[model samples]
Target: ALQRTPLQHEQSDILEQQARDEKVALEKATDQGQYFVFCDTAPLLTAVYSDFVFGDTSLYPRARELHARYAMTLILEPDLPWVADGLQRDGAHVQKPIHLKIAQELRGMGSLHYRVTGSGEARLACARAAVLAGNTHIAATGWRRTI
Candidate 1:
């Protein structure tokens, strides 16, 4: 098995590679005529994480450019229970702060985004409504639509 490097010790080269990989995926999806590419994560998050952990801004330019290509971004809250995934996730303690940073970054870029909350079916319903409405600004109720 390949040795798993701890996230904190992840090198710049690997991080850059991850961002490039994400870019390729996004481009491939767009080229394939995928109208709605549902990425569970993206370079934006990678940039945010890198900045948060290593105080690096190298990924921001590329991340911001890629972020603008998205029609909408659904920022899920850390309301769900935390499960350990070794080297992938930090901990529940970091979720809120990281989430806030993501929102701040989105707002800074003036990207269309929404903060999604709730669990299970309710969560799905909220996200579905946001996507289906295709509204620039989803009204605040259980979710917060931000521009």
Candidate 2:
């Protein structure tokens, strides 16, 4: 199991205390990870629009430049059984069973790794099972943990 230092627990407590809602708390929790902020469709669209309207028409380029500056990987997750109008990108990974193979390819390409969570209540059950199984490291949609 991953060891959680007292400081880490304190930080988690502080984040939970300060968050306005559970979603905010979850995001804050994930922020504690080395590579956090895996962008989903909504945030990406909001960011694109914010930059396009208020900043520059070359906003996407500028954003990519900034991401490159920070050496951050922009990972796209469309969820499995891909839906139409979902976020599409050159390097985006589809959320289908076949996409598992695609994810392996991307991992080989040094893009990013991926995992599929079970559906509905099963998802939470899976997470709890992982925790019980002594899986210290975990990264999921709304939460991550090293404990």
Q: Which residue pairs clash within candidate 1?
A: none
What local lDDT score does residue 122 receive in model 2, on the 0 to 100 scale?
67
Regions of model 2 farther than 4 Å from truth: 1-38, 41-98, 109-114, 127-147
Total clashing pairs for each candidate: 0, 3
Candidate with maximal TM-score: 1
Error of model 1, residue 96, in angstroms: 0.8
Clashing pairs in 2: 79-95, 80-95, 81-95
Instruction: Please give the CA lDDT of all the candidate structures.
Output: 0.72, 0.35
Please, what is the TM-score per model? 0.74, 0.26
Cα deviation of 54, candidate 1, in Å: 0.9
